[model samples]
Target: MPSSELFLIALATVLALPWLIWRLGRTDAWAPLVVVQILTGIALGPGLFGAAFPEIHRTVLNEEVIAMLGGVASWGVILFVWIAGTELDLSQAWRERRDSTVTAGLAMLGPLVLGGVVGMGLLWHAPGWMGPSASSWQFVAAIGMACSVTALPILILFMERLEILRKSLGQRVLRYASLDDLAIWGLLALILVDLERLGKQAAFLGLFFLATVILRRALPRLNPQDRWFLSLVWLALCALAADWAGLHYMVGAFLAGAVLEADWLDQQRLDRLREMLLLVMMPVFFLYTGLRTEWQLGGASVFAAAAALLLAGVGGKLLGLRLAGRILDWPPGQARLIGWLLQTKALIMIIFANILLDRAVISAETFTALLLMAAASTMLTIPMAQRAMKHFQDQSPEPSKLQSQR
Candidate 1:
């Protein structure tokens, strides 16, 4: 078949299958369309889709078609992460430092410790879990970080869907997630540190800091429209530079937006941009990621591994939040509900695991396990939070609900 025809087939399949399942299945109460899209991506991957229909997979995802999808997926993820970084409200986190610090600290630490232990056990029992490039410590830390991740973007989407994004409890959840977001990236940067390229990474950081200073001063003066374009330019530069420096372009894309003020961009426009990207481009990334999945460890083994990681991730999060509630004297049940929200992980965790895979810090089997855990974790978020979010909404003032809509 012609390259154009094959590309169209691949593209249409990527876009149509997930939406069709989401619409026809009507699994919104348990699984959002995005989660369905993710699962669909996996089904379309080599592990299942290729295994089931090898000829169709090859015909549709030829070299040229795969390359095209890869290019789009790369940019889609970079822009998505950039916007996530831009949305971070560090000032608000600092203002609510006492509560945020205790909650976020415990939330991350608990998972990190438990996940690290799990990583070690996996390494012992399952030799293929670690990548060739990864040292024992790096593999442990990377897996631990994966367990600790709270996908802020997915959390925001779920909160909005639950009509809690603007509520006081919702705002508080955002704060905790925001702080954890900063920590998550910082930890990733640390894990990605190559001693051989230490000097280059340091140079990238110094230059990035200088460039950030100039942009902060210059961006505020620009008309809103220009700032939008310029932000993309900055995003491109940072992504390219970071990839060059061995920190990975995604890291650079994140730093590019993390340094900028979110208020500088029009919030409404930002929201729309995010929605459109998720609607149009992000599925391409998910499909590409799914293409990387391999279940060489066998289906039962992979599922078992995923269950272990899920236990560490979800169990540790709830445990951590319960401890935080005790320390802060929260009302009963608050910690459990918040823990469920914090358990939301999809894109960011996948992004993190992708970095580990790209750097050969973890093997495909491990990546497959983490991927399964992310899908399962994300699937649980809406259903688990629905009851609590509704209760809170009923108690919330009418003005607060209106504010959330805005």
Candidate 2:
């Protein structure tokens, strides 16, 4: 390897150490340490100082290194998906179930409808703005699709912050979000397949579903020791296959999670790998995103449009959760907390935005704007959720449902 490459590797390790230390510090910020990694990366990676530190930057944040870092055992997320599927309180959703499923369904629907509607209306009112760029229905569908998503990791962080990991509300959000990801992935998969202009991929898409169904049934046949090893292998193979199939690796990830079948699996190899990811691999991923993402795109109008979309994203979620809380007659405090949490946008939107950007389905200007919108939405939401939960607590001093989460 070149001297520069070795230095970059050394730099990545040096920068990654703080997050590992922080993870051991017993702070919730440990979960959000990706934020920290990026700050450090910007200081180290090429730009101004990076130009001066060109050797350091090349090794650590260069295309090869970033790809490796960003790709850090993303299978950790895959394992999480598996754990998430197994941990689902289908019973809670079922026995107490009103069409809260429908509510969750509409929670997604309203946003999709609103996003597309807003896009069309804006273009209709102004001529030559984006110049027949985004159609009303396409506007509605894509943006709405983006808006309707809730990030799983963000929810996990919110729960960690509020100390609600074991509560019914937390469980509810996790379950609903899991369902949301499923629906969104299914739709996105279809859209992407269509975009690939690959009719054969369509058959393969159906095959992926059928294969997952068959594999879930077949997985149990392996002996105990073999099962653990084989499962990880299954994850790697499926993940790569999804990538090649033009489905971003999330489909494989979701399937990997959905198949785990038990909590015991988390305590095994998956747990160990997840720990490693949280310690080293994951922080690099975030740092990589922050250090690399271009922030300086677009004029005032694009910023305005992006801003408006984000507000709608946040508002749409809070409104949906609040409405559900009311209909369920959930304690006002808990209901309100739910509103905040629903704003915890997830990975789905970010991934979709990239696909749109990559396909030139949206302008680079619009793409950068929306990408920023996703990051901003994620940043602002954690606080929004925490405060909303707090507000509910203050208004209802009677030890309400929200408190049960703690």
User: Quick one: best lDDT, which candidate?
Assistant: 1
* Model 2 per-residue lDDT tens digits across residues 333-377: 665566566655534465466555544445545554565566566
lDDT of each: 0.88, 0.57
Candidate 1 steric clashes: 0
Candidate 1 residue 25 Cα shift, in angstroms, is 0.9
Model 1: CA > 4 A from native? 388-406
Instruction: Provide TM-scores for the models.
Output: 0.96, 0.74
User: For model 2, what is the C-alpha lDDT against the true structure?
Assistant: 0.57
Worst 10 residues of 2 by lDDT: 397-406
Give the Cα error of residue 313 in candidate 1, in Å: 0.5
Q: Model 1: C-alpha RMSD to truth?
A: 2.0
TM-score for candidate 1, please give it.
0.96
Which of the numbered candidates is closest to the native, going by highest TM-score? 1
